[model samples]
Target: MVSETVSVSVPGNVDLAGDLEVPPSSRGVVLFAHGSGSSRHSPRNRAVAEALRRNGWGTLLMDLLTEDEERSDALSGQFRFDIELLGERTAIAVDWLAKHPSTSGLPVHVFGASTGAAAALVAAAERPDRVVSVVSRGGRPDLAGGAVGRVRVPVLLLVGGRDEHVLDLNRKAAEELPETHRVQVVPGASHLFEEPGALEQVAAAARDWFLQSAGSGPG
Candidate 1:
């Protein structure tokens, strides 16, 4: 296993901090785009990353915003909903992953949470060749706007069963996506999947989808 802290440079002369981990004989790399107000250290994302690593995958958990931007967003709630900026930054991170020595040429998957899910979809649409698949957790894919229609890769939309509104949103987004898409509901869970075993279910489903996309899942 190889683990390191990395700095990813995006547009606008900003640097984002990330934690990268690659298992020996990695199958691929999954880039995590955390939701509004979340950071690279998101416990839920970290848990999922750990699961992916244990299964011979590389994971990159990056903060979509710089420290200064985070502080400002915290005060004024200005940047959290900037889906365009978030999407651009996420796409640029994919470029960074493509060029990085450790992750270069590796198939890339995107895991997005909350508003970050919209950004993830945008990134997938923008970098069709670089991103192999995408998984969104309790995400607002509707916020991705028209970019949702342009995504060519497989997409998995995971919503908590009880997160009714978001579930509906995912359904609507799925309608606009390409045929290779699924909207999966996690039963007995809420928006955050705070119930015991709920998050584990998410991690498992994500693992399956990513592996399947990489053609490494069960026959």
Candidate 2:
């Protein structure tokens, strides 16, 4: 396997910092969209990425915001909740991956956490010709608004059983999604999935989802 730090440029002069890992004979690549107030260095997301790499899948974990923007949002908490902006950034990253030589030609999937899941759904809607599948970990898919209904690709929504409100929201969002959607609740886990085996379950579920959905064709 090979791992490297990459810089991806999007529109509006924004440059995203990311960690890309490609395993030998990788079947596809999964782009990670972190939730509000998080970044590419999120430990939980990194763990999941490691699991995917072990499963022979490439992974890209990128920060959706620039340093200056993150600093500004740290005080006002404004951009963190801006799902449209986040979705646009995610779409740009998808395009970047499509054009990047090393990752191009590989089926693309998205793994989103929290609000990032909303952005992932929106990106899936926007790039139906690229994104093959999407998985949300403790995500707020309801925040995707009408974009949720437009996501034709298979989607897996993983929620913590202990997180009642979020689970309810996932259920509601599933109603608007295609029949290929699924909602899995990990028992004893909260929003963070900090329980002993909770995160492992999440990684396993995500790995299986991406593997199963790979080469199924575009969204």
Candidate 3:
């Protein structure tokens, strides 16, 4: 596999840092949108990315916010909840992926965590033809507002069984989605899926969903 630290340019001359990994003859690529207050360096997301790479999928873990924006949000906690801005950035990342030489021909999938899931849904709605599938991990898909119903591709919502509130929200969001959507609960897991084998299960489910929906299997 070849892994590189890359920069993605968005509107307003802003560049977001990303870690991109592409394995030999990868069947597809998955872009990761991290939760609020998290970045491309998130351990859980990285673990999931590694698992996907092992399954012959490439991964791009990128920060939605620039360093300055992140610092400002740290002080004011404002930008993290700006779902519109986040969604736009996610869409920009998708555009970048479409132009990237290594990943352009492959199908695109998105894996979003927490609030990032909302942004991912909005991006999918905007680029219905480009995005093949989406997976949310303990996400606040309800926060996506009306955009949730606009997503045309298959969606998989993974939540922790013990996380009652998020589970309810996932159910409500799933209702707004099309019949291709599904909600899977991780037994004995919490919001972060920090329990033993919980994150692995999330990765496995995400991998299967992407492979099936995108028609990309092991290389």
Q: Pick the candidate with the highest TM-score.
A: 2
Q: Write the per-residue lDDT of candidate 3 for residues 107-189, one digit (tens) a residue.
A: 88989999999999999999887888899999999988999988889999999999999999999999999748899999999
Q: With candidate 2 superimposed using the best TM-score fit, by how many Å does residue 195's alpha carbon deviate from the native? A: 0.9
Q: For every model shown, what is its TM-score relative to the native structure? A: 0.97, 0.98, 0.96
lDDT of 2 by residue, 171-216 (tens): 9999999748899999999999988989899999998888778758
What is the Cα-based TM-score of model 2?
0.98
Local error of candidate 1 at residue 31 (angstroms): 0.1
* lDDT of model number 1: 0.92
**Which digits, one per residue and each the tens of the lDDT, describe model 1 over residues 59-158?**
9999999999999999998999999999999999999999988899688999999999999999999998789899999999999999999998889999
Total residue pair clashes for candidate 3? 0
